[model samples]
Target: MYVKFRKSSRVFLITVLFGMLMILSASAQTGAPINVRGSITDVAGEPLIGVNILLQGTSTGTVTDYDGNFELRVPADGVLEVSYIGYKPQTIPVNNRTSVLIVMQEDTEMLEELVVIGYGTVRKDDATGS
Candidate 1:
C-alpha cells in the first residue's frame, strides 16, 4: 500500500501529531490523582487549627481539622503550599510521598506592625478617630 500526502496535507498531519504528543506528555507528567495525608504544626509542636493547604498552581485546596491533620487528592507531582495567619508559608513538593509534615514559623515582622483597614498602615503618632 502506497499513499502520498500533498505538501499542505503533510504539514497539517505533522501539526496534528505534534499536538497529540504534547497532550500525552502533559497528561503523563501530571500522573494520576493520589491521596496525600499531612499535618501542620508550629515550632513548638502544637497543632495549628484552620491552616490552609493549597496545591500550588491550582485552586484545589483544603483546611486542617481540629487536630491539624489534612488529606487531599492531588496529582502525584503536585506541590503543596501551607499557610496560616501570623506564620510564614511553606511550599513542599509531593514527590510521590503519601505522607508529609509541615511546621510553620511565626512571621515576627508582621506581629510588630499594625495594619489599618483600607488605609494600609499608620503610625500611632498620626492620630486617627473613626
Candidate 2:
C-alpha cells in the first residue's frame, strides 16, 4: 500500500515554495547597491558648483554639477567630506543614507597687505609713513 499526501499537505507545500521564491527575489533586490544624491551649498544658501565631494580616506569622489547637485555610490559604511576653495570643509557621516544637503561656511580672515623687500619682508603699514 502506498501512502498518499492529503489535499492540505499539497497546498502547504505549494505555499512554502511560493514563499521561498518571494524571499529570494526580495533579497536580490536588497543586495543591490544604493545611489546617493545630494546638494552642496554655502552659508548664503547658494549652490556651489565644482565642489569636491569625496569619501573620507577613500579615492571615491564626485564633483558638484552646475546646480550644485552631486551623485555618488557610497558603500554601506561610508563617510564623506565636502570641500571647496575658500570655503570651510565639512565632513558628513553617511550610512545607508539616500540623500544629503550640506551647508558650508566661509573662512574668515583679516585682510592685511604684505610687502616683500630685497632684504626682508615687511607689512604694508611699516612701509607707509607711520
Best by TM-score: 1
What are the per-residue Cα lDDT tens digits for candidate 2 across 1-130? 1335677788899999999999999876544456889998887899999999998888989999999999988765678888876677788977678899999787643124555567876776778553
lDDT of 1 by residue, 47-130 (tens): 999999999998999999999999999989999998886798889999999899999999977655544557466654464678
What ranges in model 2 sit over 4 Å off? Answer: 1-33, 110-130
For all candidates, the clash counts are 0, 0
Candidate 1: segments with Cα more than 4 A from true spot: 1-24, 114-130
Question: What is residue 99's positional error in candidate 2, in angstroms?
Answer: 0.3
lDDT of each candidate versus the true structure: 0.88, 0.81
